[model samples]
Target: MGKPGFERAHHVAFFDAMATELPGDYDKQEVNHLTLSYFALGGLSLLRELDRVNKDEIARWVLSFQVHPEAHTDVDSGLFYGFCGSRSTQFPLSNVKDPCHNGSHLASTYSALAILKIVGYDLANVDSKALLQSMKKLQQPDGSFMPIHIGAETDLRFVYCAAAICSMLDDWTGMDKLKAKEYILNCQSYDGGFGMVPGSESHGGGTFCAVAALHLMGFIQVDLASNLNDSASIDMRMLLEWCLQRQVNDGGFQGRRNKASDTCYAFWVGGVLKIIGAYHLIDRCALREFLLTCQSPYGGFTKFPFDRIPDIYHSYYGLAALSLLEEEGLEPLSVELGILSSAL
Candidate 1:
């Protein structure tokens, strides 16, 4: 068969369906509605068809998730003043007395901000001060951030989300960068890849979070030589080598050693290489061909070529990986931010 071509119209329809209404199979994603919105909105932005959505309506829906301090007076009341993951997670305006029902999450907040920016909404109306206050409370003594104020898994993922939130708001006051840097450094495994936490096994997603967080914190200087090695500096060369190794003979990247390559790692691992300024080291043609194999006949990309089912997460990252390759007709993606250059 000829090289798999992009099904532009079908992909557009896929995103449009997500924007308007999610299918029944997506009911499980109701808790992470903001994340779903991000994937959908980010996909549209990548397709250069963000104009297809009602920007004002989408922006308003996103803002509605924001928590207000004046709404509750309980101990946990001010804990979640950022943004909730979905409408179901949000406390109704009339029920401001119940703080237990309202909880803002770091990842959801990050997605909210990203979606807002992608839709061309000026964040002037965002309650930056309140959001920053919430972010500060989420950071533990160890410098890792919990996904929500109520306490949850603290890992590199939420750390990256906190960093991305602060970067978007142009406020470093939300997190202690020095402590965050220390935590990130500790998460770097002996193999040169980063893990979710100290002493954890190295993984692609964890490495991306750590690297992108450091870059957002201004700890990773772009001018730093990739070959430079010092006791105080991260070994960029070793990290780059580890990332490159994830791209197996199949051309697609695997999240971990001895694992099958997945579509998402194309961005997870590829984004890391791009951030390190060593993306040219990869086999671009083979990687592109591998990604094409994962593209579903219906429109979006699947997790693996044989999976046959497409999802928003893999689809967005697939497009992003293609963007990093400077694929024709695709917008350039900001590796660190994981959004289209135009969106940025």
Candidate 2:
């Protein structure tokens, strides 16, 4: 078959639905509204149609999630001043009086800043001091970051989020690069792929987080052999080989060993390969064909070709992966920040 046509109208409609009203199944994702918004807004950016959305209104809505230190002067004051995932995550305002239950999340904060940039908002108005202060508190002694200040998981995903936040803000004071590098190095599995934490199974998403975080922090060396002996050094060659191995014969990538190929891995794994300067080694034509198969006739993309419906996550990554492949009519993506290159 010929290359599948990009159903722009259908994809636009899909993003519109996500931006306006989510389906009933998305009830569980109510707390992650910011992330969902990022997917929709980011996808529109990739489609070069971000102007279709209300930039000002969306920017204001995103800013509302910012937890100001002055406003939240309770015991957990400075700790929760970044940005909440959604309004539902805000205490007092959401009638959630439990101070411990409501707080800013690293991932949400990253998405908020990314969407703001995507919508053409200037970061000068953002309280970078407050945001960075809150961000610093999320980092543990080992350099891994918890999604939130209290009782949250510490993993490579949050580490990437933290790095992206600092990179966008053009400030490194928010995190310790040496410690973060040590943590990332520790998370590398023997097989060369990275995991969520030390000694965990290697995963595509985690690998992207580790590699992208290093890239954003300026720790990635162009000369792979230059940093081999350093305590926090990454085995660039081995990691690149592991990422390359993720691509199956059909052109799609799997998250882990012996798993079925999925659409999102195109970004997760592809992003890693691009960071390591090994993207040229992948079968670009076959990967594109595999992603096209996952494209829904109605709109967006599913995790796999047979999935009945498409969600925002896979849909956005599908577009991003296509962008990495230099697909026609798509915006080029910043592999490290996971945003459109124009946004930077």
Candidate 3:
């Protein structure tokens, strides 16, 4: 592929291929299916590939999965289900018709926004006010938000989701800023990285979420400056350094220590490093090579080196990694490639 025959490929085709190949297996159930599709379709839109898809039909499909605006589900127990493929008529994912559905997930909400925005849909079709209200109602006393109605484990990731939602809406009324910041700061692991929860294992994804949230809040630079006396500032810098070193000889990044490198973690880790002003610390050429290697001849990118199968999650992340590197030939990509260029 000298230059991608991008004009010939389309979003619907990519997603149909993925949906057919990776069905609703136990490991990749309906919820994950929606998550991956959201990312893939949204990624395509940002790449100007939506011209090939049924934008209206795909938009309708996404709206079908939304919890009814009139349902007025409990903020505490009613988790926003990811997406339903005609599975059941449940108000929410957790308790509706079945109990094993897990619950509303923060990741799903995040993915949903990205996908919708990519397709050029505004907040009009969604119960924007109600969803914001629900988000506000779900804030915990500890500042960190939970992902489900019954409250699954509280963590930094949800904090990021909550913050991103607020950022997208251009409002912070839904979150307790002071306490949310406190919780995010508290979750910084000793390794100079942040984790899902306090004192948990440091992960590249969690670190990016936390860092991006803080940056979006306009507190990162000043806070980092003011916290010069605080131990957390050192932790922040150390986290940046750790992320910078994640690039292997092949140019991809790993999520945690000792794990094999993957294309997606490049964005999770590299994007954070970029925000922290440390992206240049890595060997850009090598990382670009690794990401390029993961790109399928068909247009999408795989999760790891030479993995045959490719999905939206990896495809978007791979594009994002290239975006960070600003590779010579490709167009620019968003930090989360799922957010369409039009949305920005």
| TM-scores, each model vs. reference | 0.94, 0.93, 0.80
Instruction: Give the Å error, residue 267, model 1.
Output: 0.2
Task: Please give, for residues 39-105, the per-residue lDDT of candidate 3 as tens digits.
Answer: 6565555455567667677677666666543355554444443333333323544445664453445
lDDT of 1 by residue, 1-344 (tens): 67777677777777777777767888888889999889988988888888888999999989988877664454333476788998778777566775456678888999999999888888777989878876787888899988887678899998999999888888888999888888898899999899899999989999999988988887775543633443236777778889999999889999998899999999999988777667788999989999989988777889997567799899888888888888776778888887766666
| Displacement of the residue 307 alpha carbon in candidate 1, Å | 3.2
Instruction: Give the better candidate number (1 or 2) by lDDT.
Output: 2
Ranking by TM-score: 1, 2, 3
| Evaluation by TM-score, superior candidate among 1 and 3 | 1
- Model 3 local distance difference test score: 0.66
lDDT of 2: 0.86
Instruction: Please estimate how well model 1 matches the true structure, expressed as its whole-model Cα lDDT.
Output: 0.84
Give the C-alpha miss distance for residue 206 in model 1, angstroms.
0.5
**How many angstroms is residue 199 displaced in model 3 relative to the true structure, after the best TM-score fit?**
0.6
- Per-residue CA lDDT of model 2 for 183-213, tens digit only, reads 9999999999999999999999999999899
